[model samples]
Target chain A: MNSLKPFSLLKRIRERLDLQIALAILCLATAFLFVGGYLNYLRAQEQERTGVITMVREMVAVVEGNAAIAAYLQDLQLATEISAGLQSSRYISMVSIDIDGGGLVSTGAVQSGRSPDFVLELASPFSAAETVGSIKVYADLDYIEKLAASKGRSVVSGQLALLLLVSVAILWAVRVVVTRPLGSVVRQLKKINLSDEGSINQISTRSQDEIGYLADNINSMLSAIHAAYLSEAEQSRRIAQLERKFRLIFEGSHAGIVMVDGQNRLSLANQAFQSLVAHLDPHLDQQEPRPLSQLFYDPELVEGILSTVRENNASVFRDLKLAGEQEVWVRSLFSLIESQNSAEMGYIEVVFSDISDRALIEKHFEYGATHDQLTGLLNRRGGEARFRRQVEQAQSRAGSFVLCLIDLNDFKPVNDIYGHEAGDVVLKEISLRLKSALRADDVIVRWGGDEFVVSMLAQSSDAVDAVGRNLLSVFEQPVEIRPEVWVRVGGSIGIATSDRVGFSIERMVEAADEAMYIVKKGDKNSYQVFGDSVARSQSQA
Target chain B: MNWMIKAVWILLAFSGSLYAGDILVVVSKDSPVDTITKRELVDLYMGRSHSLPDGSPVMKIDAPVDSPVRAEFYQALIGMKVSEVNAYWARLMFTGRATPPMSVTKPEDVAGLLARNPSALGYLPEDSENEQLKTIFVIKEDQGAP
Candidate 1:
């Protein structure tokens, strides 16, 4: 009883519009036919009555003289003949002749003893002074009644046939023009492929009726739906492609990236991100990131991001580090990601990169006290010294400059799978390529292993990108480390220029870092430039 | 149109006239009577009395029901419609008390039948002539008679 649901049978019938309309018409037609047939039957009864009376009257008129003669003769046989002639009428039950002097002579087909319908009498006179005898005519109703009944039956049958034919025609016409068409439309609606825009167009009947209007309205509605579906499909396809590229970048980059939901649970984390978190706490690799406070070496960054997002919606830090034996450093950017409805800030997106070896960050507080011996290029310290010199020169002299970060592709496999001797040889080969590709005014610095920073004294952003592209093209062909020992390496470069407005040395380097991440995120072995306007626009984004 | 004419004839016969002709109350030349009044004529025709004014047993001769002259005769004599006269006779006959007048479809037959039965009485067209029958009275049609 608890599981049973009540369905209304009447409601189900009411919902069928065609049945409702057809029944209404059929009921009206049946009523008209019934009334008309009944009236016709009544009229036939009257006609049969009149005809029977007229026939009996006519038969009496024909036999009047003979009946008088028979009555005068007192001849029973002659009287019987007069009565027999009336038998042909089928409506006479008896005929009688009576004379005062001669006894009554009567003859007829007697009924089963029921009263007669009517009696007719006429005087048989001997001369004018006396009526010597009389003739009596008795009429039976059976023949006229039978005839009337048959007439009624024929009328009824005719009316019924007419009603049946008319009803059949109405049903057929309705099925062809209304029910079948509507049924097809309903069936068409049932199987419509909502995803396909062309599925909206159907019902090719050309008419100016209500059904046509319905079809027209449906066609217009389908067209609108088709247009919306097409536009949405294009939008979703583009979004999926961008999302795939975004996921590839977030996962494939040397940096770690993750999203924490509004509940502070790790909603998304890629392999590099997992490894980075594992570096802080190794046991986090196989477990779901519940109680996010435990997954982090210090929960302060997440808590700060949450508090700031509650008020300002987003916050970023130049650099934050985890205290450990191997110092882990990252420059973090945080923002509150919103739901589609835009009614509330739903979650947080935190993007961070391994900036641990930015020892130049410390040197930016000092000057020129850094160098690297392995590749005879300036280390992080010298790179910061040269960057400060360029900043000061640009502010005082009002000159322009471009800063770029270049990351070596496939360097880890060469160093880890091969040996350090092969790694050193590969690094020296890249150093020689940079020397040959650059102008003498360009300052090149190897900031760390498999990382380089370059400063070109150029204001235009496009020329900076051209220089970056030239550097990438250098590594397109493999380098020869030994006799007939060939190895392939690719480079991804990020460029930024001080030519546009809002250019600080820090922002320029951050823009360059962001652009380098883009090249590594998509199809690799490419270069990208981040101009000042683009960097400023994306700072909040 | 034929039935309409018949209907008009019947109406004229039963209703006496539309301010025009009159009827001749006729009897056999040997009827042994001279004349009769309209009151006596009505009694003899309606079966209220079965005898003539001369105290002889009487028989009435009539034209057929559809005959215009017969309708006029009854209307003029007894002031009765054909259906009323037929009903009266039907009731009398059913009770075995009296029979209606002997009838012929032709007015000529009515005059001939009256000639043969001296105790019989009938009406005829005013201009009709017969050697064996005699007209005893001429009843004016209606109130407009001069």
Candidate 2:
């Protein structure tokens, strides 16, 4: 029952509109019927009053005329009979005789005291005659009663008929004018679909009434609301689609991307970025935020990036070494985000895009330009630059260094015998052996086809000679080109020390060349150092 | 000329007697029975107002609709005029209380209804009765004539 209470109350209220309308109509009809009935009653009463007055007046005239007739006859009994005859013929109640100054004569019925008040007077029919015996006549009001009753009934019945007809007409009119239109509006409102575009159906505006105006306004409002709803829904749908596309781009990009805030703290790092950092510095995989400074081993590099960004207010791209181990070239793009009030919110963006492959390719191009392609060593141009820089530094510091020149003795014959391809392989193998014999700081150059040079920085002339002998001993073993073929390639070496000879890089290379020719003239397997005599002889020649 | 005058006089006297003996009654067309008992006739005319003793519907008839004869008959029987009867019926019909009596203009019509409908109650001159229709009651001329 408690649960049903709300439902029942709702039902009652829902039924109230029609119920109230019906009740209002009933009340209006009842009031109209009552007013009409009362009016008809009043009309009948008025007519009855008028009829009664007229009948009384007519009865009085007849009574007066009869009195004159009675006087002319000069017979009391005959006059009485004449009055009785008139009374009976006319359906009058009574006719009476009165003497000149005294008493009454004959009467039809002994009159009751309850008789209605009447106007009495003496009269004669002739203008010039004395009043005869006065006659008292009682007015017959039965006809008035009958007339009033008939009129009252007719009026009531007529009024009732009129009321019935009018009430039906009014009820029908109200249903059409008010109820039906309102019901239609309600039904349309219920069926209105907020999702569909142009769903609002226009209501009629034919009438210039308040209801018509209200419907028009409501329809316009609904149309606006529906349009707004559809527009917002469409915008949100497009936004969702763009968001999905952005997510795909962000997640699927191969290049590592890391977003840094203005505070130099890592804000967002994509999966690629995380993997890149892990590859560059395995320690970065620890559960801690790596500062940009810490990610780069060089403080100067970090400061350069920050200063560039601060000065230019733009992005910076450079090749950077990660923790002094791995070199990753990255292009960073940064931008500032501001609020609507134009206050700087923060910096957001990506330091992304691995140009490592590009960097490797560029390194290869640089290496190709500076080094010989076959022997994997510095060419003449690169070797000259290295010799000059080393000599200049050694001269300033009173340091000693050595330069060696070697020319392969049987290289051309081996190339002519086994073809140039085997010759190239033999050259590559020789370059590998020479690199292995020398220290990392020493420079080896392929001077030309079947010719090579080596440069080494040293502390003294003895150190220079030891390094030169080690270079000469590396070619003592015969090189193997194939399983059955051992190619015994040999080269004559000539060494020159920077402090002892005191020559420029080119002059030192010329002295070493002269010494190398002496070795070749003696025996190809041996080596010689350029002494002051050889240099003087060469200068004189 | 004297004999012709005598013959016309005889004819006139006969017609006068015939009319004096005749009466008329009227009833509604939908009345169920063709004849009524004497008791039912007395009750209906006298306004005693009861159904027929045999449990049939009793319908009282009125005289000529607009004639003085209607006034006289109703007045003699029920102490009211034709106008009063109409008013009574108007009140009944308006209030949804009762149906009004039907009316016939001629005595022959009354006699015919009486012959056809057993529950029909009406008045006629005493001399108007025949084997086809039964007389329920007789009233002297002073009582009422229609």
Candidate 3:
């Protein structure tokens, strides 16, 4: 009996890839063997049948003449001799001869070949045309069975041998093509170590098969992953360094720095900010931090700053006075710090410092840049800049205004006679008179030398005319050049307005100067308004 | 012509065989053919497609399968060996074609069987004559050869 090992072996073979191909070749070989064996068996059987028939016929032919003599003479011995002769053949087991009308002779039992036996009709060897006897020869079938057995054994053995050959070949092919390469790939995978210093990031295989392609792709993927890991580590280190630098800068900066997270709670405050907050309230708790609003004079100031930050996302609160006895003035910049990815994470940072002293000096410098140093009226350069601002206001608001030029009458004579001090006092007094006489929104400028210019917003041209007439009479009462020695000096005034044609600043100033020169020429100390001058000229024309 | 008749079937098989001697063709007295040429008899025997001149189908016969007259008849008819004729009939027999003629043991029965069945045809030695059957043709031996 075969053990169960062969069945288990078949299961193992079924799991393997080579079994299907091997089985296919085995089936073909088996079919060819079966067909070839059957055909060969058939041919052998036919040759055997033919041999038996031929042997029987030859046996009958040899004893035919004697069998005829036996039939003619009624001789039994002759018939028996012929029948006994058939036993010599290997295929012939028995023979019987029956001569007609004489005797019957038989030898051996007819136990051979096919059941009905092989019979041959013997014709008497004579020209007399007589029927004598018939002969029956039995054939032996052992040769047929033997031939079939041998042929069958050869075909089965051939198929078995072929099956074995095909199986071995398929197994070798599968090992080379499938199993060995996959084992190598698995071994390579087992060798991958990310933390090892000398670990390989690529498979070394250069084969052009599918396994090779798979290995290469896996290696490239591993390389990509390793690169990504390194890049991520590098970026994290950089972020840590940057955060440390930022903390140092924040702590060491001169300005008070405060950071508030997106939740509107104070997240960070530098030493300067805490000390400044401490300066705001002397009796504050030192153990806990204060709300950012407590450092300001008013709670509304913090609210306003935060609202501005919320609305415009950034704002500047200039000259914010800290709530302290020393009256510290600070300017603060409030900014919304957004996350890098623009996600919801963000905070607000306010950097503030004491600006009280600098603000005072800046105020003084601002006044000095635009105002006359001697009379405190606007100088020519600064007055022109103000004049452009006023012109823009006029155009944007659609309000009209006039520019007036006032020149001192004979001021050079007084300067030469009184040694220039008198002319200086006269010019200062004129600018003062102009500022006092004009509306609060009006601007007065020292036009250099003995001249002064004034800008007035008026409802009618007659209002400027009235101002011009008043300036002309201002030196009527002028007397003291140096205490009791007085020199009387009047003024010539010229005016131009937006209501007139060609209303640029330069043209307006020139038109006013032209009218003033006209007044200076026709009647010194008198005034000429450009509107009235245009009317007078047109009326003359 | 008589030499050609003997060699037509027999000499073609055994090219150096002796001449056919004293072969006679016969029919029943009631047969439509009182006489037929030797070539016409051979056509009927070999199953070639020819009608008797009277449009009658032939009922051809031969001696027992082992008879010498059976051998001589096929030798004259189509040069076939006796075994060759048996194989031919065996092919035709199993397929339900023409059955081989009935067998007779005695030579005298040849004339009696023909006389009983009018369409029966057979052969006899050339020296003999039968009252019950009519001779259709004679095949003389090659006695005048060199």
Tell me the tens digit of each residue's lDDT in model 2 across A286-326: 56655666666575777567656755666666556566556
List model 3 lDDT by residue over B1-146, tens digit each.
Answer: 99889868675567443334667778887888887775566545644323575787766667766766677777666566789867755644433323455567776677777888887778877766878778877765542111
Clash pairs detected, candidate 1: B13-B71, B13-B72
Candidate with better TM-score, 1 vs 3: 1
Q: Write the per-residue lDDT of candidate 3 for residues A1-541, one digit (tens) a residue.
A: 3798899888977765556556666677678667875776676556656766676677667766656545543456656766777666666666777776655777877544445365655553322444556666665567545654666566556656876787678768876887677667777888887644444657766467998899889998988777777778779999999999998899888788987666555667787776766754543335544466666788687866776787786666666877767667787888877768554355678888867775477679989988889888989988898888888887776777789888887788988988867777877776666766666788889888778888866665657657766665566666576768867777777888878834488999998998888877775666777857431311010
Candidate 1 TM-score restricted to chain A: 0.48
**lDDT comparing candidate 2 with the true structure:** 0.66
Best candidate (score: TM-score): 1
Chain B superposition TM-score per model: 0.77, 0.59, 0.70
lDDT at A20, model 1: 71
DockQ, structure candidate 3 = 0.01
1 versus 2: better DockQ goes to: 1
Q: Please identify which of the two predictions, 2 or 3, would achieve the higher DockQ against the true structure.
A: 3
lDDT of 2 by residue, B1-146 (tens): 99999998887777542233324343334544445443355345533245665676676666567654555556555556667657644533433323456789774587777668766777665555566655444444465422
For model 1, how does the per-residue alpha-carbon lDDT over A1-541 read when each residue is reduced to its tens digit? 5344334545655777667766787888788877988888888887888888888878788887656645543445666667777765677767666765767766775655655454444343223334656766667667678889899889888888888888788877887788777777777777777687464656555556887789788878977887898999999999999999988887797666767776777777777767766755645445666545455457776576666775786566646665456677777777777678653346677777767654446545444346666776777877777888877776676667788898988888888877888889998888878878898767789967898888867654557646866777678778776779888888777887787534577887788788888878765677777743232111110
Clashes of 1: 2
- Quality of candidate 1's docking, in CAPRI categories? incorrect
